[model samples]
Target chain A: MGGSSGMTITTARLLRAVTLVVLLIFLFRPETFEPMLALLVANNAPAIYNQGSLLSLTISHLAIAIAATAAAALISVGFAILVTRDFGREFLPLSRSVANIGQTFPPVAVLALAVPIVGFGTKPTLIALFLYALLPIFENALTGLTGLAPTVREAARGVGMTGFQRLLRVELPLAFPVILTGIRLAFVISLGTATIGSTVAAPTLGEVIIAGLLSSNTAFVLQGGIIVAALAVLSYDGLTALERLTARRTGRVATAV
Target chain B: MIASPRHKVLPALDKLGVFIAIGLLATLGFAPLMVFRANRIVLGETVDIAQAMPPGPMVVLLASIGVAGVAALLKTSAMMRLIASLAAIAVLAWVVGVSASFLVEGADAVARASPASGFWLLFGIFALMATDALTRMDPKPSLRIGLVLLAGLALAAFLASGIWDDLSVMREYENRAGSFAREARRHLFLAFGSLFMAALAGIPLGILCHQVRAVRGPVLSVLNIMQTVPSIALFGLLIAPLSWLSTELPILRAIGVSGIGAAPAFIALFFYSLLPVVANTVTGLAGIPANVSEAATGMGMTERQRLFSVKLPLAFPVILTGIRIVLVQNIGLATIAALIGGGGFGVFVFQGVGQTAMDLVLLGALPTVTLAFAAAVIMDALVDIMRPSGVQKGSQ
Candidate 1:
């Protein structure tokens, strides 16, 4: 607590800068992580960075993520809207419980169950990702749609907007930001999660990590992990930027800052 | 949106209920009853309703579905709905039992059988009906808990009745019956051990973040970033550091801290469990009103006294929630530790995946999921119970 205010250095800023530098080092020269990794791992692993092409793994990783996200977005938004509608209102608790159960049963379990019906490779991975992505996206959509400002609703109704028209013109626009936030979260989490796709013989960054683990190759593990982490961090940052823009447009509190 | 009122073909509660009932009955009448298999993993020999099992149990299941439909049409009480739902689960169990008895009794030692798509669909329909019934009833958590236990116990009793001795998953379990207990114990060890370590480290860090203005932002960001790091990658990342530590430090190796096995898995799980616990801790403390603490100060409370008396108690429920989340999540995540030879349920998961034996995988998965669900329910109930009288609305 001594001279805390007097110090010119901002700890948060300093930490962030240091973190960025470390991450950059990890990207360009993963071998540098070797000595540290070597000391920590059980085996005397030699420096061998970029075990596979990070570029390729990242592409496929993003590919799986994007596909999963797009599917999840469509289904979740539709389901949310359906459940929120008059005819479907009674299904809310059922939908909510189903979503909760999806989370309760781990995504890995979903992958296991999926493989039997779908077989190994991208299809099962996609299915698992789709299931894993549902809870967040659906919950957020419900929250956004249901948690509308009453005045906004009243205003839309007063303007002679039909139910569908009010939903499209007013409710959806207001809810878009929250929904976007959900998509963003799903995307980021899915990026990290899709690593497991490698276990099922789907091409992903996890292949490198798994390869590394099997051989006690710290450099390989670092190579795989750094990229995955970096991608997630970048995706998170990108989403935050979009979220802030949405917040500004909507005049809602900027949660992340 | 103005919903058009349709002519009443079925009563209000019975509209969806009756639909489900008819669908269930139709599927049963048309679809195969159960699948007969030579062994695990291969496509099963299909048996239609006439040959599948005795007409007795199938008839009972059919009767239950019909009754649920009729009950839905009537003005039913909570207790009535409960009975209807429980009856549905019971009948479903009996159907499964009868199918199992037929399959097991007919099969040889290596041969196995399981309920095929028709049976699974019947299960799905019944589950939906039961969910609808439960939702309508909206029983108290304790009552719901009791009902779940009762249903679970009934199912367990059926499984133990030796009627299901040849069901693929149980047969798989029987094969590894000795190792199953050991693996289960190891799984619990990993989950609890990591949780223990996480709490030991996280709480103090959370406290430090709360008390120290300088460290909060930096610490939280690091933890956040750590959280975003995927579980597998985190485990991978830990191997080298832990390996080096064990080798370089003889004393560490003496205590069995190596890079590959439980050590790295524990570290990874510990790191993953941190954010929730710490975030909750910080939130719980910050949520305490400044004026309340100021009042405590005016009343001659020391920092420790104010913290324990005001902050800690106020934060206890939230902290417990965080712990609960961590526990449930760890139970699920520990399955991955099997890949690293950490000896948890993931062992079966991987073996199943490798051998293409879905039953073996379920052997591991079902328990993990059940544990997660049980943990969540218990924690939720505990949180409700812990809430102070003024804060809690209902006296459960």
Candidate 2:
């Protein structure tokens, strides 16, 4: 923790606090920005999206993102753990390809395809988000588990730790930071992607943006974009800090995470 | 330690292969091979494989499935597994084509027949098995590149033969053949054009960041923040400003700049492309050995000469990797750009979604997947071929 520059941390915290305050104002009080929005658009165009509350839209957006990302993390991390074991090693190659190939799939296409099988609404969006979030978490978990020093494992064995005990106590702890980085990535991606759920009748911030687009209301578009971007940037910074703390605790040198 | 009796009794199984084979068998037995819709937007009825294909083609398909299954279950060599997998895929394609022809017989222009969940499942399983075999065999880089080209040729041939003309997605294509070509050209242009612009600006910025300690922190942080902004949001944010600019400035309007079109989308993609290119450039340059640079200095080469002749050459591969990442990323993002009238494959995707037509969605999606996959594979092979032999050896 001390290795990091104090000045950067201070500036980051300041930025975070400012963004939070501004977001709160935007969500709770649209009138504050309506004047500015009015200036941007013509007189006839609506300055704000009045059909849905911004706060509720933000909440629903977050709810879907969290649920999908949590589910993806659980399944993907479990699969990674399973395949790394001796009995499941034969599946390593297949699992790797599945994760890699899944990433190559565009999120928009995935969401679009899901509508055919599941029909429209939040169900398809959730399913798509889950599938989209799986790759990064799985890849990171596999890397974190497999990249353990062989000597560390031998040392644990020398100390008479059973396989389960060693895995629980040492492996999981050491891999936690890396796995958390994956979860952060997955969460950020899910947050952005869940905004597109509006196309399929899911109540999300995307509804605002899509509505704005259909009506050619630039104010509505800008408002939706601002809220979503704030959520992403703030959450990303918070997660990075958490990841760094965990890495420091585990004595792992953090690189770009 | 004595080995367990159960361990001795059980032969080691290729579990992934077995899993795929089981999925294949399950799909064959229970899932529908095709769907027949009375019209484009109607809910389709599932058609069984037995009802769709004639006995001769059915027998051939069954034989290929059996071969794939046997090769998967047995302790077969990689070559045998690869052959079985590819043959099974080919047979599956042929049978699907036959089934489409059979199903569409005497149907009106509005009628549609398309591969259902079962056919897709089989395709995915066989593709997985083939990939596994290829990975295990670890073919030479040149051979891998050749294989991708061969696959592309086979796809072209498949399309040219009109075997898939009766399929619903192909019908969607037939209806909009002109627009489909235009959108495809637009998609390629957006993807490649943005990449070219990004590389033009990014490489130099990357070098600047690497050389100047003061610029690195602020520049990278800004790029990181830009990256966190969703593509949709970025496009939206650009609309107001760009439109305002175009309205205020006649020169910009004359150049085709607009609020909610290609201009905003293009600019957003350029911003997204910068982080990867710049970061990779810095990394590649920083990776040069101190001794090598010192040697160049000792040879009395000017700073500019050392940079262009020595540092840039060493960093080329890594920079190329960054370009590959950006290209694949930009291709995927360009689809979303269609929402704001950027005009790419995404136009079909969003349109299909609005119309609730699955075939139209597939028509848009399948090509995007293929393009991204091909880009990744070609770039990977290029990276492998371009890497210095000594560096490759040392890394391994």
Candidate 3:
């Protein structure tokens, strides 16, 4: 106990302190970061996000992310339900391959390929994000649904519930937590990947990162990195919390709970 | 949707099939099959290739229409569906050759000829018909492989026939073939080199994290935080530190560590690989059943012997899954490395974007997509073969 007390600087505490410092540098005084850049760079150029407020960049980033994730969720979940049904059973392998096509596609290639067809800005980024997010959501939804206890589904059928009714009332609720896990994975990953959207004029936090890259400015990179990292951690935690909460509420999802 | 007594095949979507058939017929009848151009990439006066080209390939067109019509019938034979799809694909290949034949003949007068919207829609309908037919037949893997090989052979025959010389995309490829090959090789080098470095660093780091309880939490959290940083930002962040290293340490600079180029790209990719490798390693090691280790010990194996012989062998496949993910991901991220003069296929993509040349973009994109897809399939097959039994599914 004495030895433990002697060293009060725990790793967790250090991590917390470092995180706080990073946040302060990102949000308040980015000037504090310039010195580190000056130390690292020969031509330490100051990088800017835009002439406008950084808050707008943050919002635009979040907006695109949320919109794309939401769209992906809607389509992926529907497709999952479709492929799992008796009529759509034959499409199961094809669906898996198609969803994987999104993952196999590099978002950079998707972005480059998109610009010619979709033009610039949020449209292309959203398309890329939508494609990038599909695999996780689809795979997870399939797992969640397919992994259901046969007895529970049998009970649902025995209870005279129609296919749609069982999906809505029994299967979906049971699968909700696993589906949320997929959403969480997709959301956090998208938070990082959406930065690339700024390259195609999507006006995300990547704008700062790209600018910093071009100009050799470490401070701008830190500013952008800090925000994105924080956003990822926060969203990851928040989604996890939501998952746990829903798992608890849906007593059927006993494993995660 | 009802299944007839003689129709032994699965329930077919006759409505959708018929709709697509009608669409295919309309496309062939009304829309110009392919457009001819007088200059490269310039939208010249549109001439319908089907109407203007000699020997028309009318027989193939009529065959495609007949196949589509038969497949759309209420109770078509599975054999008929297979023939329809194969015919549709054959027609697609033939149409491209026939369209390019005119441009090839008038190579001096015509600089380019491209498939217009009609061709695209027709292709889509044919592809839809093909997929529908495939789902019906559910052909064996060997049969599917044969079909793919046959299609590839046909396309190669077309290209070797020199009939597509006036196609704009091919023209772009012709100009950049030398640099394209070089860039493709360098792109591969960067991906493989980065993965090698990642394994070198990550595998041991993972072992350390797994063995050392004190380091596990901090190491994992740090890597997690590292992963959350966007690739662009991480690459940007590395430049300054890397440049500093080069400037401050002359010996390091002598080895070609620099502010830009492959050094920073490799560093960033290394960071990206860490989370998966380390996490999977930790998971794999911790997941080892207690009895398995006890049996090794009971057999008089030392700690090193147990780890090497028992734990590692048990864990290798799971750890391999992580490496597979990293390898595919690295192939993709290497494209961004080109932006920093790291020399990859990305040069063409970015240059195309700059020039607003879509064909140039395809020259880069098509290969990158193929590389990524091939890496994924090959790795999946490798993992399956290495297991020999069956994969541990949800655990991965």
- Per model, the share of native interface contacts recovered reads 0.54, 0.46, 0.63
Write the number of the candidate with greater DockQ, choosing between 2 and 3: 2
Off by over 4 Å in 1: A1-52, A254-257, B1-10, B13-19, B22-33, B69-75, B389-396
lDDT of 2 by residue, B105-175 (tens): 98887888999999999998899889989888888878888998999999999999998888889989988
Worst 10 residues of 3 chain B by lDDT: B387-396
- The list of candidate 2 runs beyond 4 A from truth reads A1-7, B1-12, B248-251, B390-396
The TM-score that candidate 1 achieves is 0.89
lDDT of 3 by residue, B1-396 (tens): 555765556455565466777787787677776666666545455555456456656666666767666676555766676677667766766667666666557366536666666766776666666666666676654565556566567767867977666666677889988999899998998888888888888888888877887777767777877888888888887887788799999998999989888788888988898888887787778877788899999999999899888887777777888888988998888888876767788888878877766678878887898788767766765555555254354144
Clashing pairs in 2: none
DockQ winner, 1 or 3: 3
The top-ranked prediction according to TM-score is 2
Put down candidate 1 lDDT per residue, B66-96, tens digits, no spaces: 7766675565764575577568767776666
User: Comparing to the true complex, what docking class would candidate 2 get?
Assistant: acceptable
Q: Is the docking of candidate 3 incorrect, acceptable, medium or high quality?
A: acceptable
Q: What is the TM-score of each candidate against the true structure?
A: 0.89, 0.95, 0.84
Task: List the TM values for chain B, per candidate.
Answer: 0.88, 0.94, 0.78
> Model 1: how far is B2 from its true place, Å?
24
- Of 1 and 3, the candidate ahead on TM-score is 1
